[model samples]
Target chain A: MNRSTGFAFIAPLLVLMVVAFNLPIIYMLGLAFWDKGRGFTLEHYEGLLEAPVYLRVLGNTLRISLIATIANVAIGYPLAHWMRGLGRRARLIAIALVVLPFWVSILVRTYAWIVVLGNGGLVNRSLQWLGLTDAPVQFLYNELGVTIGMANVLLPFLVLPLFAAMIRIDDRLLQAAASLGAPPRTIFWKVYFPLTLPALAAGTLLVFILCLGFYVTPAVLGGGRVPMISNLLDTLINQIPRWEQASAISTILLIVALVIFAGYRRLDRKASA
Target chain B: MTSTPWSRRLLAAAGIFGLVFLTVPLLIVIPMSFSPARALTFPPPGFSLRWYQALFGDPRWMEAMSTSTIVAVLSSVAALVLGSLAAYGLRRGSFAGRDWAEGNFMSPLIVPTIIVAIALYLSLAKVGLLGSFVGLVAAHTVLNVPLVMMVMGVAVRDFDLRIEQVAWSLGASWSYTVIKVMLPNLAPSVFAAWIFAFIGSFDEVIVTSFIAGKYETVPKKMFNELILEVNPTITAVATLLIAVTVLALAAVTLVLGRAGKLGQTLVER
Candidate 1:
């Protein structure tokens, strides 16, 4: 194909993306910095710093995102490692289990946690039946519920890539270590674990970035008790009509997410290579 | 590594627990949807489809369903056409900024969806298109474009260029060659991409909630209802959504499996 025709093939989408995607984001950034009469100001960011509520929400978002990412790594690493050792049929089933929920609506998954963690729900019922507790434990409308929901929803994001990277590990590498008289533990820790580290780090960053902006899960699972950054932005935009503050916060979040994404890209390239 | 029996058993136990933790919510929801009682008790009093009945009987729910379907169909088709064209160009073209263009096209997937929602909400409201259906469809198309591009980008790259070259040498016009030769070869991938985009738009909640104004898609209504209170009717809706996803996935797997692209599509990226 000629160069012009090649450009022609992409022209329609390029136009659409520029007008709809890029421009909207740039306009939002402009809103963050621009003032109605004064031309430009940092008043919106100043407002965010002045309020304790904004700081609390920022702290909550970071703490929750960190916990969820850690939980994902804990559960996902073992799961992916085990999957690497699975038979073909079993591996396929495991992948399906992980991927199915990923494709489901985030709302549905978040809501299901309510049913499972509610007063009369499964976990509480099981606990009470086992005589571990006299009453149902509070798991909904709190930080605990929010963290668990976020971890569950974001697990596949960590596991899938980690598993893919795991499967690519040549078994001979481990066997060779074993042949060198390294015990199973040493072989796993020294050879296998290190090999998977790049992918693991990449997946961890991806999940953390996702958790930072989580809205629906926190809204439903936390029941307005846990105010993450996204919920704070929602309140600023919709309830109180503070667009400038919301834009300022969103600008910070976008920059933070992009920076972490750049790091993830580097690790991901190394993992795949 | 699998030699140590006790360690292997421990790993297996943890892996099974992880899988259960991941899928138990879905399993619980499906059974709860069929419960005769209103309470979310797992072992129901008896089997009943009352929730499904409620879902289908309510005109509001029906309207939301139709709105979701229309928006999904329109946006997915738009995404498929535009994304496929762009994917073809990005793969075959030697443009100077081709890599940059591809990254820009894929940025929507990387940027936090909440940011996308707020941006669109602000910009659309600024332009007085916030509540418009056109605006809604356009947003969905943009959001889903990355999905279509991912699938079609791989497909276009893997497709042999010599076939198209032969068609061009035989005096077939570019459009004729694409329609007759390229489309037939890429049909499986095209179908898979369309299904992905459709599901993406249909299940969209955050963006739809922000910008849809009074328009209610199923997910939007379901989310609103969940926030206010937990209704058993949503269980039915959740189950239905799961069913649709499973079916769509199965269809994609079957088509792409026949084309021998399933593993590559699923695992490679």
Candidate 2:
């Protein structure tokens, strides 16, 4: 296609980006610098730095996201490897099942967890049923619930990339290794594992970034108790109506996401090279 | 593919068990929604259509459903048009900064939703668009465009443009060539993109919670209720949504399966 027409085709998307994606962010960046109470000032940033609550929330957000990301990667790798070993039909079934939760609404998924982990819900009842405990478990509305729900929602993000990497693996390499008297475990460690690193790295980055920004899962499952950055920002923007502090928090989140994204690209290039 | 020894067997067992872990919670919600009891208990005492009946009996649930459908429908359409054109350009059109352009388009997915939400909320407030249906639709459209673009770009790339060139040589206009020759081949992919966009818009809560206020989308309303009261009604909604999701996924999978590029086709495409 000619340059003019090609540019024309891309124009609508660029317009969309400018209006919806880029412009809002630019607007928010401006809001971050402005004080909601008075004229333009650095008070928002100062408050963010000085306030112990904001610092604690930021720490909690990072800790929770990190934990969830690690758990997802750990679980996703083994599952992806296992699925890769299955026959075509079984692999498809396995993947579809793994991804089934992806189709559920975020709200619904969190709600499902509430029912599963609530005081009067399944886990508590099951524990009692099995006579393992007399009392119901304190599962929901805590850090533990937040971690489980977030990890569950984001598992597919890890699995898809890891599974994709596994499929790209050449069977010949494994066969050659085996023929060279390498045991299955040895071949997996030396051959398959290294080859899958790029995807694992990619999946980890993707999940980490995603988990960091996850708001609803934490909010619903965290029960206003475990305040993540997103939840804090939500309160500022909605309840308190402090646009500047909210903007600052949001700006921090964006910066972290960008750093993670840049790291992902660097790792991806190294892996490919 | 030849199977391995014990490791393979172990991997298979682990994989199946993980699948059960992933799916059982969602599975439980379905039967729980059908239970005669109002409270959720595992191994549901008895199955009945009480919750389902309540869903239909209540006007608010129906209204929420309609509102969700409206938002999804409008956003998906906008995404389909804008995304396809952009994807077509980036794929077929040789241009400088094409990689940058594609990445820019998909950046919405990577950017923290809170950032997107805060920005949109502020921007909408400036333009007198806050709490407006149009604002919410616009946000969702922006959010969904990347997905549609990704899918359509794949479909367009795999498409043989030689046929379109031939049609053009036979005196067909560019639009006509695209419509008659290119579009039929692309119809399924386009439809799939539409479904994905629809699903994405419908299920979204984070961005919606920020953008949507008193003008409540179903998910947003459910979120409000969830924060205030943990009830079986949300379970009922979850059940209906899960059922729809299963059905929709089955349809999409069948289409992708028939296309013979089920897994990779979605991502790379």
For model 2, residues A1-273, the per-residue Cα lDDT tens digits are 688888899898798788888889998998888755686788779988898999999899889999999988777888888888778888867877877887788788788888889878888888998999998888888999999999888988888767877887889999999889887778888898999898789789989999888889888898899999888888998899988788888888899899999988777665545
Q: Predicted candidate 1: interface RMSD? A: 0.8
Error of 1 at A70 (Å): 0.4
Number of the top candidate by DockQ? 1
Model-by-model lDDT, in order? 0.94, 0.84
Shares of reference contacts reproduced by the candidates, in order, are 0.79, 0.75
Measured against the true structure, the TM-scores of the candidates, in listed sequence, are: 0.99, 0.95
Clashes of 2: 0
- The parts of candidate 2 lying over 4 Å away from their true place are A35-41, A269-273, B1-10, B267-269
Residue-level lDDT tens digits of model 1 in A1-273: 988888988999999999889999999999999998998999889988999999999999999999999999999999999988999999899999999999998888988898899999999999999999997899999999999999999999999999999999999899899999999888888999999999999999999999999999999998999999999999988899989889999999999999999999999999999
lDDT per residue (tens digit) for residues B185-247 in model 1: 999999999999999999999999999998999999999999999999999999999999999
Task: Indicate the residue-level lDDT of A95 in model 1.
Answer: 92
